[model samples]
Target: MEIAVCRAADVALLDECIGSPGAVSSHARRFARQGEGGGTYLVAWIDGRPVGHAEVIWDGCAAPEVRAALPGCPELNGLGVWPPELRSRGIGGALIRRAEELAREYGRTVLGLGVAADNPRAADLYARLGYRRLTDYVDRWSYEDRDGVIRECVDPCTFLTKELPSGSLDVKRT
Candidate 1:
């Protein structure tokens, strides 16, 4: 599988293949954000199909607290793997490694991400990827759905960061 910055066409396919209308709108917005230099929206593909995704926020995180606390650290945001059955096949890990590689390319020494407090599984993934807890924060963000309606979200999250100077993703797969 190859991981690369998502394009508008890829976002359209991602939306149709794995998302709802709202998600389509969100993905489109992410695509726009990428164009504006806000972040790098990454998509992983297998056999010409999109399978996984992750975003690296070049400026910082959406959470205000995290931004203030970890200045200059790029965020690994909105990570996901499509088609639940396809999970645990290393797609997600590949997305993460790609994100880390981008961070290194940008001269960033640290990369951070937030795992929802309720999702220990994702937290474990981050831990195994060399991320350690930094703090807890309420993740808040809003987005415009397909119908042009704005939606809000608030989730409890544990912020984690990893030093990206030099590390190999050789942690044993469970």
Candidate 2:
């Protein structure tokens, strides 16, 4: 699999394959086409097909509490893999590793990410990638679904932060 920053032309195919699990279909269009934010979407492709994706939020943590706690620490958010069978095959981890590299390129020393409190598998994955829990908080957000209906999400999350090393591109896993 190859990880690359998403291009505008890739959005439609990405959506057709991934279908936005967290009401983030808009984001694929946003970053991939509009380039509205400081961050970008890193896409995982295999055999010329988009398989996974994650966002590098250069501005830092999206959660207010996490932002206040770790100011200016860019975040890796909205990670997902396409086709349930493709999960657990290191796609998510590779996207995260590429995000870290992008953060370093931006001269950032640390990166932060939030994991839903109930998802132990993800927490374990982040831990193996060298992220340590900093605090827990209610992650609240609202989004407009495909039907244009406003949805409220109030998830309890554990915010984690990792110090990106200046050297070595290998992602640590244990």
RMSD in Å for all candidates: 3.3, 3.0
Q: Per-residue lDDT of 1-174 in model 2, one digit per residue for the tens?
A: 899888878888887877754456754654743287767788899999888888887786667788778888887888888887998999998898888888877888998889998899999999999999888888887777867788888999999999988875665421
Clashing pairs in 2: none
Best by lDDT: 1
The alpha-carbon lDDT assigned to residue 66 of candidate 1 equals 87
RMSD of 1: 3.3
**lDDT score at residue 74, model 1, on the 0-100 scale:** 90
Residue range 12-82, candidate 1, lDDT tens digits? 79887668446346677778889999999999888888888888989878777887889878999889998
Worst 10 residues of 1 by lDDT: 165-174
Error of 2 at 165 (Å): 1.0
